[model samples]
Target: MNNLLLNKRIVISGAARGLGLSFATACAKQGADVVMLDILADEVHSQANLLKKQGLKATAWQIDLADASNIKSTIDNVIAHSAQIDGLINCGALATGVGGKNMMDYDEDLWDRVMQINVKGTWLLSKALVPYLKASSAGKIVNIASDTALWGAPNLMAYTASKGAIISMTRSMARELGEDNICVNCILPGLTIVEATAYVPQQRHDHYVNGRALNRKQYPEDIDGTAVYLLSNLASFVTGQNIPVNGGFVFN
Candidate 1:
């Protein structure tokens, strides 16, 4: 544990499992008190307990990003319990089982769901937390996008579009928040091996492996460092950047 984030506090969405849990664990290991938000109440709470048992500072809250009021209430609660939120990692989205549909054939409701949760959710959470973050000395916001958006993966248009929006929004957020010493950035990670990708077809996985210059499966840990670095003082001057962390699958 480098404790790069020592004396810091971070909030992460989708913290029940997969990369969300991994990011939470990684940040906590760096000595940051974490607030893990997810819709899975039992699972998120359980995971937070596990982290606490490891002598890490973690708190879990069940939240639905699609709800604006819920987002506000949750942020208020987080501030009440833990003041001075230093960073936010928007890792929550509707990715599992949301693939396999062609762009033209995508169900209207499904596409809307993706946009509502992935795109609007990121906006809402970031919007609500900016005020608190502005109060911090060095505030950081990291939106977890996808390399699929950059590579233009077929048959996953809705998910890809939603992530693409996040990349764009990160830049705009950074521009507006830069004056306040707050950095907003996006991470376009490759297809990683996690519970969330269980439904992804094997052919897609092979495509990433073969196309990647690294020629290996990407893991959550592979990109966790980028998140940690951005949240730390190392990335104080870096803002409004969309970084691709896909092992050379796509150069962005």
Candidate 2:
């Protein structure tokens, strides 16, 4: 436990039981107060309880990031309680299960749902939190993206498109927030194993694992350390970059 994030306050979205949870726990271990927000009430609360058991400050906020009004209120509450946030990890996203279909087979409604959460949610949440981040001496924003966004996947047209938007937004956010001392970056994770991936076809998972240079499946832990680095002093000079944590799945 190096207190890389000592006394810092971080906000992690979709942090019930996956990559988001991993980041939240790791940040806690590093001495940062963590606010976990997810749609699942019981699960999020359970996670908060676990963190508390470890003697970490944790709060669970039930939120639907897709709703602008709710996101606004949530941000107000978070800032009110924490005073200021040192970092923000926009890990909330909706993919195939929530409307990621092949381009030709994709319905407009399904596409809208994915875009609303994955792209619009990220944009709005970050926009709302900009003021707090700007006020911090070490402000960082890490947007979770997917490698398919870079290479473009066929069946996951909507997910890929939304992620591409996220990547673009990351660069633009970095440029705009730089003068304010806020670092905006995106992490394009490979096919990492998580609750979300349970819906993915087994063959698809196998394909990703076999194709990766590492020839192994990616776990949530693989990306947790990267998240820590991006939010710490170690990455103070880094911004507007899309760093891949996908084990050479889609080298950029």
Candidate 3:
């Protein structure tokens, strides 16, 4: 084991699958106890069991980001069970079929749902967990934003706007939590090929692959290293920054 995150207890939202699952697995590999949260209860439990079978400390919780009450209660239960939380990976978000629509053509309901889950949900969960995080000796928050937020991607206004909000929130949160020894940072991932993104049009996928410096497909595993580093001691001084794992799609 690398032991980079040894003895740490980390919470990963959206951990049933996709990038969130990858993060949980990576953290656990490095010796961190992982609390995996997702709306898909069965999937989350199965994933957690798989980790346990690997002799790793892992647990699953079902949570609906769109529900504030659920978020609070779930977090409270997490704290009650885990006793302390060292880090958080905010990967829970809502990006259904809202892409490929013009700003004017965007569905109001879809836009509202995206905002509620992606923007408000991220903030509220972080807000509710801040107290427990502050109590830890090493507190870190890694918010998963999108590269589209950096260079606006056409036809993805709602998702892009929500991620932009995440970046801004990360900056402010870093400042506010600095005194408490909490480090907040944002990771902007490129167009990764995940189960959730299988519905993305082929043309859009090609556009992302062709425009990248790598000129290849990006996967959830491509982001694990950066996420692990940000949550590990290596990033002790890194805060309020936006790091891109987008195959150099947008240069920082």
C-alpha RMSD of each candidate structure in angstroms: 0.8, 1.3, 0.9
Stretches > 4 Å off in candidate 2 = 96-100
Q: Show model 1 residue runs off by greater than 4 Å.
A: none
For candidate 1, lDDT tens digit of each residue in 11-67?
Answer: 999999999999999999999999999999999999999999999999999899999
- In candidate 2 the C-alpha lDDT for residue 92 amounts to 91
lDDT of 1: 0.94
For residues 1-252, write the lDDT of model 3, one tens digit per residue.
288999999999999989999999999999999999999999999999999999999999999999999999999899889778999999999876779889989989999999999999999999998998999987999999999998999999999999999999999999999999999999999999888798889998999999999999999999999999999989999999999899988998
**Could you estimate the TM-score for every candidate?**
0.98, 0.97, 0.98
RMSD of 1: 0.8
For model 2, the run of ten residues with the poorest summed lDDT? 95-104
Candidate 2's clash total is 0
Q: Which residue pairs in candidate 3 have backbone atoms (N, alpha carbon, C) closer than 3 angstroms, thus clashing?
A: none
